[model samples]
Structure formats: structure tokens, C-alpha cells
Target: MPPEPPDTDPGRLLAELIAIDSVNPDLVPGGGGEAAIAGFCGAWLAARGFEVHRLEKRPGRPSLVAVARGTGGGRSLILNGHLDTVSLADYDGDPLDPCIRDGRMYGRGAFDMKGGIAAMMVAAARATAHGPLRGDVILACVADEEHASSGTEEVLESFTADAAVVTEPSHLEVTLAHKGFAWFDVEIEGRAAHGSRPELGIDAIAKAGHFLVALEELAQRLAQGPAHPLLGTGTVHASVIRGGEEPSTYPAHCRITLERRTVPGESADSVERELTAVLDRLAATVPDFHYRLARGLHREPFAADPEALIVRTLARHAEQTLGHPPAVRAEAFWTDCALLDRAGIPCLLFGVDGAGAHAATEYVDLASLDRVTDILTATIADFCS
Candidate 1:
């Protein structure tokens, strides 16, 4: 028999969350979706007096929005945390088994980011236990953050909040900004002919080398460019490449899929233009070079006003909880905070301290989990009141 759900204690809540397999199916074939975990969370919230709403726009892929309605007029706050995790196959031990040792909880999603999810869950319950605040406290346990973030995307379509906090394991620090990403495909065209007839065939694979070299040059140029105060400069690199099928015949096409990590000022359009310029230059300089650049998925970078009400409130609580000012930091990776910010909801990221986000080993500091819970509870009370 499975273990029962824990009480309001953040550490126990985190353990229960870790024990549930909420791996993103989009990332791993036949992986456990958010169904089981979403059900658990929904029941947990419903039992605690939250009006739980389960969103399953995509069948079998559900996201939960649990709300504690406010009594009167006050700014609502959204506490966001993804319910899905990366593949657990590579975990060093039993991925689903939550263990505690040396004041740390070890499990696949313990750190990134069931810890944050548990903290926020307990915090929201605690903050509104006595009575409803003037503003609503909404806890969003969304799906698909590991792959497409379709869960958050769907949530934004129906819900909006005055402010939000993404619990994404930021080492108990305040993360005001994070890098975005843009994907692109560069297909190089070439003439197919027998290998012996070099004169009749244009080698697409060889031509791709030119683009790869140019891409490196572009990366270097980006490195030399002016950097964002926290996020630094944007970066580009080839992620996947497919070319010649066999050595007996000349290949007709070579496709290169690359990803560009962008700072605040950069966008998919900007990155496309940069790639276009590089390709155009190569076309003009390299002989028989023909190619097409196609833009793929993209997400915008996020930057929060350090002076925003939510930021200040959370930071103050965090400082009080830690007995020291929480350091303001930035992440190179993307998060749902970007989506919330783009939707005009002011948001920042703050969560428990941990390591091994997608590595073979993972763990979250038990003390930090409790501290984060205290910080979030205080912040929610102060901000929503």
C-alpha cells in the first residue's frame, strides 16, 4: 500500500510529493503525467478548504489551481510550481523513494522542485488558516513545465493575478530575472549525386561546416557584447544535426537544430535576424551554399522590478526568516515566471536550497524547506492582506 499524504509540515509534504512519479510524458515516452500527483494535490487542497480547480485542456495532463478566496478588496497573489519532473530513469537510487539523511531529503524531484511545491502548499494553507485575507491566495500546481510549459500556458488563458511567485528552487534567494530560449532549424540544401562524381554534387555536410564555424563566431561575438546586469549575454549553439545517410551517395540535405539562450533585450525575432545575417554572409562568401532558416519554439526572458510590491514583500519576509537579507540573483534557465510576467503579472522566483536538478543525485535541505515555507507564508499574509 502507498503511504498516506502528510500534514502541513513542509518536509513531510515534500516527501510525499517526491514519492509520487509526476514525470513529464512529453520528455519521456510513457512517463507518468500529472494525473496521479494532481489528484493528490487537489484532494489535499480540497480537504484544507481551498476551492480546487483541475484543468485538463489536454486529456490526461492536468493542472491544479487551488484558491483561498479573499474577504474583500486586496491584491491576489499566485504561488506557482510545476508538478512535472524530468526522467527518473537515470537516478542513482530508487527515484520514487524519498529518503532523509543529514537533514536533507533525497529524491528525483526533491530539489527541482517538489520542495518548493510543498513549501508553497503549506504556506498558502497556513497563511489563510485563521481567516481569509483581503486578497486571494492561489496555488497553481501546473503540468508540463519540463517540456512545453503548456500547463502554465493554459492557466494564463483563464487566470490572472496581481502578483506571482514561482517556487523553483533558487537556493532561498530572490531571482528577479532569468534567461529565455529560442529554437531554430537551419537546413542546408545540396545536389545529390554518386560519391565519385564530385563535380555534379554539392556537399551539404561540408557546407554545414561553414555555418557551424560562423555559429561559433556568433557565440564569441555575443560573449564580447555588452551583457545584462544579472543574466549576462545571450548564447547560441548547435544542439542536433542530421546530414548524409551513407558514404556511397552525396547527401541532398543537412539539418541543424540549434538553441539560443537570450537575455532581456533579445527575442526570437532578434535571434532569427542574427542567424539570417550569418547565413546570408555565408551564402555570399561560400560557393554553392544554399540554406533555409526556420524559427521554432521560443520563450521570452523575464525581469522583475526589484521594487515591485511582491518582490519587496517576499524579500522582506525572506530576510526575516533567514535573519539576513536574501541575495538577489538570476538564472540562465527559463521558468514559468517568464510566462506570468509576459501576461503582465509581476512575479519573481524564490525557493528552497538544493542541488542536482536533473543530475543523477538530488536532495533538498530540510531546514531550508522549512525556512522557505515560513518566508512564503509570511509573504502571502503580508502581501495579500
Candidate 2:
């Protein structure tokens, strides 16, 4: 294919990416995940003469790594974003439909972040067309970000970069750090018996109620203390619970799912241990009140070095392009940046301006999209020059 246009308008690319549904592994029912978006990115990058590598962690879920070679003197800069989005499966409207209204792009991943991916793509294309760069530009569009970051983990296992940028929805600001998350399911076991003979059996539902109270206390304590400078301390909340089976019979078992946010310097293992200790203490009170804890989703907190070259370069570019100095912030939610950071890459988060991520009728401002593209292009030039 003839070399793709140098000035690859990001708007067109955003529309194309939004049209592809690459919902994450957890969100997808049958586990076929992120393949469509990966295919589109791979094809698009390859057609633009980039050296593209496609990796699959599972069948039909692929991640793409595209490289533009330069003078090869300095370390490579990794421009990363996930292809998978939070499932729109629950959405009543068509998730794949990309709508433009009043200069805004309305779609499932419009802001968080097909828009960011489009900016990266356009920046890479522009840099390639401008001739050889001083350093390599690596574009990593991965799968499973909305779930467990399997694709990012795969990248971390095999690849290393000097610095990295994760294109999450940061409202065009620099995100130097973010809190991690741990999800778990706790099961309390008890004996079941007829309602008329309630004294003959132990009630798991009652035990669960006590445990929930303890969890609430734990959450409150963490919230009031242990605040981090950026990400704050931590948080815990019981998201779901199930116990009783029938009204006529006493329930035998209860399961509660919880989500815990961890700040920097906190480990998922530590959080699990703390929770287990709480359960053990409760078990001492009730002999048959034993509970088992199983971890589900676990991600560590990530904080990029504020003085890293990539972060500084991007901040400067944002100021130049948008005429305002980018403010550094922390996200309460988690992203694949944690995976990359653990892999020893300094990862900063930045993206287009938007709101209502993962909510209905998600939209991204057209002006923000344009500004992101311009800033990204300039950052790439600055880094590779």
C-alpha cells in the first residue's frame, strides 16, 4: 500500500476505532475479546509502513505493537493504549454506533479512549512521514484493559521501554499516579434447616450480616487514615452479596464480593492479609462463623516519576498546544499503567477531555480531540528529535 497520509486526521481515525467493539475479557460473555480493534489497528499501522507485531494472550484477543524506526540512538518511547473498553453489553443503545453532535463524538469509548488511540495513531503517522527520528516510537494498543490487563502483562513480560505513556481519559491533563484495586469474594458457611426448626441449624445469612458490619468499619478506618499525598490512602466497599435460598428454609451459605482501592506502597497481598485477620477475629467470636476469602481482580498502584523525560515532554507539549500548563492529577480508578509501571517502565497517563466514562451516552469534545492530536504529535517530535 502507498504510504498512508502523513497528516492522518485523528477525527477520522477515532470514528473508525469507535466503530469496532473490543470489549474486555471480563465484560465479554464468551471470552472472545478485543480482536476486532486489534485487527483494525494492526492493519492501519502496517499499511502506514510500520513494523507491526500482533500478540494474542488468548484466542481472538490480540494486542498490537507497531514500531517506527529512527536513528536508534536514544531509548525508545512507548505510546500505549488499550483497545478493549468496558463492556457496553449492558447498554440499551448500540455501542458500536459513533455519533457526532455539536462537534462532539458520542460513543462508548469515545473519550476513554478511542480518542486517545486515534491521537497516538495520527502522531505516529506524522512522525513516520517526516523522515527518520532520533529514537524509536512504539505504539502498543492492547487488549483486556477493561478487565485484568492481560495484554499489558504480556507486553511487560517481553518488552522494555525507556518511558511510557498510557492514553487513558485524563481530561488532557497529566496523570502521574493512580490508585490500584483488589476485588475479592468472601464465603461464609453455615448449616441449613427447616424454618419451623430454626434452632436445629446455624444461619449463614446472620453471620454474613455481622461480617458486613466489620467490613464497613474497616472501610471507615481506612478512609479516615492512611491518606497518600496523591492517590490517598485506600477504600473498601461491599459491592454484592448473596445468601438466602428459600423463605421456608434457613440459608446455608453467604457470599459477598468487595472492591478495595489500594494506594502506592500498599500491596494486594497485604490487603488480603488484613481482611483475613478481620475474618479470623470474627471467627473467634462465632465457632461456626468461619469464612474463606478468594481474590479476584488485583492490580497494584502506579506512579510515574514526575521528572521523567516523557512526562516533562508531554507536559510541555500540552502547554504549547493547548496554551495551558497541564496539571498533574491522580485517578481513583486503575489502568494498565500499573502493569507497565511494575514492568519497570515509567508510565504517565494522559488523554482527551471528556466526562461520563463508562456511562450512557459517553461523549468527547471535538476541540479536546484536536488538541490531544496536536499535543501528541508535538510530543512525539520532541521525543524523537
Candidate 3:
């Protein structure tokens, strides 16, 4: 495909973006990182009079922080979207070949995010086309939103805005809250001995079974516990488990890796304590239930005030653009909204109507794409005015 002509039409721009392979290497080994895509965005924005600044502290993993500097004294706004996408291997068709049928555009990243990126780029360009606003309109086209949010993390180090809108796919709804997650590894220890000798050998895998049952009970307790208004109850599940070398010998070590999805009022510390309590009880009750617990990566859940300036502004624009008040919704998955919120920038998630994010088939409704672009353009103009 040829380079897209410099224009504000989001659908056209989305087709161009989907043609480039920006699969996250962290998610898929040997995957194309954000260098090519980031460069394309920087050039595209720079051509439209944005002051493009590319941040690539992690070598090839670059993130562009393009700014349309406002006249001054007005609240700045950020339009954020991820450039990196999930792997293309599992996609049903030619993931790089963007196709438009009916009203949906099918391709990898089209719905997962590149749709939002195109919309925000066009919105930013159109919003400031006539003249700059009183405050800056910053476009953060960041990398690694699929595996880790290191891209947004780096962007926050240098730039900030009064408010932000993470254009993660939301079916055009206003997403105010979503779940967070923490990973943990549990190692169940046991003495290795001959399998034929029942008394001499303590089966680590069998002992680990006890912990698995406890984990299920814990999940059930969480499900029956107090739930968040939007996100509902927190939950836990074992993701990966490995133990023993061969069937003939008593497996000395068993490892269980689990993930806990959290709602508001929960944190890594809380999850650690919960797991520790469970393990401690097992140690006390089960005769040889020795184990070690370690917490891994975690991100906090996000919730935005419905009345927040950004949320209200975007909602208003969406309502006007869609002919109905945008529905307020929440997600089970996490996004960069939490990072933006943690950075002290009031933010919320809103984006084009779409489906099949990271699935075998992915698509974004073309009409929804145009509507989101219009809504964002108006919101940017209003919020930065």
C-alpha cells in the first residue's frame, strides 16, 4: 500500500495504520516493535504542524508525544492511544492486509486500538486546523500497551495534561472503571523419594492440589463478596502450573502461577496478604504443605468521576454526535487509563465501536470510526478552548 495522503479522514488513515505491522515484541517474540509505526505517526503529525517529539528510551520501542501548542492559560488535554498491537500469528486471515466489508474494517489492531489512534490523530489535526486553542492538545501515540504500559510510563515522565482520553475500544461508550491485575507464583516444596515407597515419598504435586482447592474456595469467596458498582467482584484463577519430572519418581517441586483481577479498593499489597493468609492456613493444616509465595506484575484499577471535566466533555460530544447520551460502561481488562489516572491527569476511556480485540477475527465499524473521530474532534476543541 502507498503512504496515505495527509488528510483528516480517520477511516482512510486507519487503513494505512493497519497496513503496518506494529506487533508488540514483548507479546510475540520477533514481533515488530513500535519504531516503524511511531515514526509514521510522528511524520504524519509533524506534517500537520504538530511539534513531534519521539521518546525512545528503550531503543526501538519509541513513543511519539506530539503537541499542538495552545496560545496559553487554558487547560491542556491529552488524546492517548497505543501504537503497539498483539501478535498477528493467531489472526484468522492476513492480519496486515486491512479489508473493509459492509461497514467494518477487518485487520489486526484496527479494533484493538489503531482505530482510536487514527481517530485521535485526525481529531487533533482537525481541532487545531483553524487556530491553536488556549491550551495544548497533546497526542500520545505510545508503545507496549499490549504487554506492559512502559510507553505511557515514559511519556508521563516528560509531559502532562490537565486531562486525558484513552482511546481504547469501548464500543463508543464512556468507560469509567475497569479491573486491575496482579500475578503471583507459588512453589510447593516436598522431599523427593522413590515413587514405589508411599511413606518415604511426599508427592509435591498432590500437596499442590490442596492449594488449588483452596484457591477455588478463595475465588468463590471473592465472587460472593462485596462488588464494585461497575466492575463487580474481584476474582482469582490459576493460570499456569508445572510439577514433577517423571511419573516414576516423587516430584519434589510444584509451581503454580496465578492471576488475581482486582476491582477498586484492592491493591498488590492486599492481594499478597490474601494469598499469604491462604498459604499460611495450608501450612498449618496440611502435614507437609511447604511453599513459597511471590507477587509479580500488577496494575491498579481505574475509575473516573462521571462529572470530571474530560469525561463530561467527551460524553457531551458523544451524545451530540450519536443522537443519544453515551452509555456509561466498565471493562474487565486493563488499559492505559489507569496509568494516566495515576499520573494525576483525570482521564477516561472512550473509542470507536468494535469487536474481536486480540481474537481470530478483528474489526472496527467504519461508521463508528467516523463518529468517534467527529466526537473526539469536538471534544478536543471544547476541552482545550
Candidate 4:
């Protein structure tokens, strides 16, 4: 049997977590990583008599794992969350400023994460305080989730869990699936020449312009393709572009950055092959207009079995605790849940209600935070039982 849930102070834990500046560099420059937050969590869990391990994938970027043992009768459940936020440089506001007003906690990572981390901690605290459970429970908090997914990847490589619940802000919905992401940089090369002598040399920018048109056409084709039942169709868009050195000279090279959303059955290699074929055909038309494709992040899509024992148990708990059956769906965004899913673990994404993540005035509803904690606590108990 699972231990009785203990009274946990989730609000104080959330405030303390929000106070730490664990914003990823892509979200904020010069902001510290997850070390401080991991340290705090380590101390908190240790003081609660839970077995805790602190793992650092990179210096100053720490990931923590805390475990509570139960009756050793069932598979383990992992509660995973990241302690990172997107860069807050343009906000002109303090990233660490966690202001609670009108039932919302305003902070850089309050919604995108931290809130989930707080709820996990509260659940873990209650589980520890109540006594032994029916099975093991692992609480994992990783770093660099806002930028690169290396943090969660490292965790998956090092540990295994039967099932995982990723605490990514999902408006308290049970997200059993999420789309993958593919990033690429396309570079067009050409000969530089004087602008006055246009006929003497090839213009890289002109070639790049043509290539952009082809890419746009491809994007449209992808958007119109058959959509995935849950995740929808893939999406392709050029996010950044740069080229040309001088106004009076034909540029030698141009580059465009693309972000592509991948649905189920879409692999990074397949996407590359398709794009390569398109560019190859274009190269045949434009003389000496060769291009190179550099791949960036290639996160895989993740889906959990709704019929899995842990998932079903959690869904029941959600309905019982939240007064409504949990909404099951797939997120359009990529998350660390994919990493665990790829490792053969059933993963689900769920968390607090909020808005404006990675934007100015990001905040998490305090009431939702409390509710999430309650849900987490009950879910863990049910899963372990």
C-alpha cells in the first residue's frame, strides 16, 4: 500500500525555486544554470531522508535524481522536469524577480518550468514524509532544456524508468504525445564580384533568393500534406537569414536557418534526404549554385500508451482530484519527454496552467500550482500503490 499523503508546502517551494536564476543561456545570458537549484533540491530531499543523487552533465549545469523506496512490488515511476528558461535579455526585467499577485507568480521560468519542479518536490516531500510506498519513485530535474536537450538525454542514458511524467506546463492537461523538431542551416555559395560588373560574376544572394522560393514552396507542400491524427502535419519555415558583406559587391555566400516540426514517422534523415533532393534539383538549374545543409537539433516525437498501467492510474487520479477527467492530447511543441520516450519509457507531459512562456511577463497561476501539487501527490500515491 502507498503511504498517506502528507501536508506539503508547495507555495514556499515554488517561491524558492523561482528565486534561483536557472535560465538557460538561450533564454538569458550570464544567468546561472541549474546548479543552485539542484543543490537546493538535493538538500531538501536529503533532509526528508530520501536517497538523492546529483549528476552534472556540464559544469554548473546539474541534474538531480531523488528516490523513495516502497514495497518493491511494481515498476517505478519517474517525475521529470527541467530547471531552465529561455533567454530573458529583451525583457528589461529581472529574470529572478518572482512576484506573486492576483494569484499568479510572475517570473521567467515560472510557467515554462520551475512550477512543475516545485510540484514534483512537494510530491516527493510528501511521499518521503508519509513512509514507504508500494514501489520506487524517482524525481529528476535536469538543466538546459530551454536551449539544448542534452540534459534529459544524459538522464535517459544513465538511468531507466518504467514510466515518466514530464512536468512541462500543459495547462494541467495530460499530454500523451508531442511533436519532434528538426533544425537546419542552408548555405548557398557563389563567386563574389563587383556590383558594377554584374555579368562578370555570379551573385550568391540571387541564387539564395531562388532557393528561398523553392523552400517556401516545399513548406506549403508539407503544410498541405496528410496530417497526423494527433500531432497534425509537419511544418517548415525559415527562421533566420544572413548574407552579403557590402552594398556594392555581389555576396559570396548566404545562409538561412530553418525550424521544422516533425510528426510521427518523420525522421531527421528522411527530412534531410527530401531537402537534399530538392536542392540537388535546384543546383542543376543554377550553375555553380551548390548548397550545404547543416543539421541542428533533431528531437524525436513521443507518445505514451494511454492504456499503460501508470498512465491509467494517473488519469484516474487526475479525474478524482481535479473534479474532471484529464484531457488527453498531443502538444505541438517539443519537450524532454521525447528523450525519455525514445529510451523506451512511457512518458506523459502535464503541468500547471500559465501563459506567455518565453515572452515578457511570463507567469504561472498560483492556484494551478497548488492543484498540480495535489494531482502529483495523488498520482504518485496511486502509481506506487
Query: In the order shown, what is each candidate's alpha-carbon RMSD?
Result: 2.8, 2.8, 2.5, 2.7
Which residue segments of model 4 deviate by more than 4 Å? Answer: 1-7, 92-94
TM per prediction: 0.98, 0.94, 0.98, 0.94
Q: Write the per-residue lDDT of candidate 2 for residues 249-317, one digit (tens) a residue.
A: 888899999999999888889999989999999999976797889999788888888888989889998
In order, the Cα lDDT scores of the candidates are 0.94, 0.84, 0.94, 0.83
Task: Residues 1-385, candidate 3: write the lDDT tens digits.
Answer: 6533459779889999999999999988899999999999999999989999999999999999999999999989999999999989999999999999999999999998999999999999999999899999999999999988999999999999999999999999999999999999999998898888888888999999999999999999999999999999999999999999887899899999999999999999999999999999999999989999988899999998889989989998999989999999999999999999999999999998889998999999999998898899999999999
Give the number of the best model, judged by lDDT.
1
Candidate 4 weakest ten by summed lDDT: 1-10
TM-score, prediction 3: 0.98
Worst 10 residues of 1 by lDDT: 1-10
What ranking emerges by TM-score with the best candidate at the front? 1, 3, 4, 2
Ranking by lDDT: 1, 3, 2, 4
| Model 4 lDDT, full chain set | 0.83
**Backbone clash count for every predicted candidate, in the order shown:** 0, 1, 0, 6
In candidate 3, the residue pairs with backbone N, CA or C atoms under 3 Å apart (3 or more residues apart, or in different chains) clash, namely none
Superior candidate under lDDT, 3 versus 4: 3
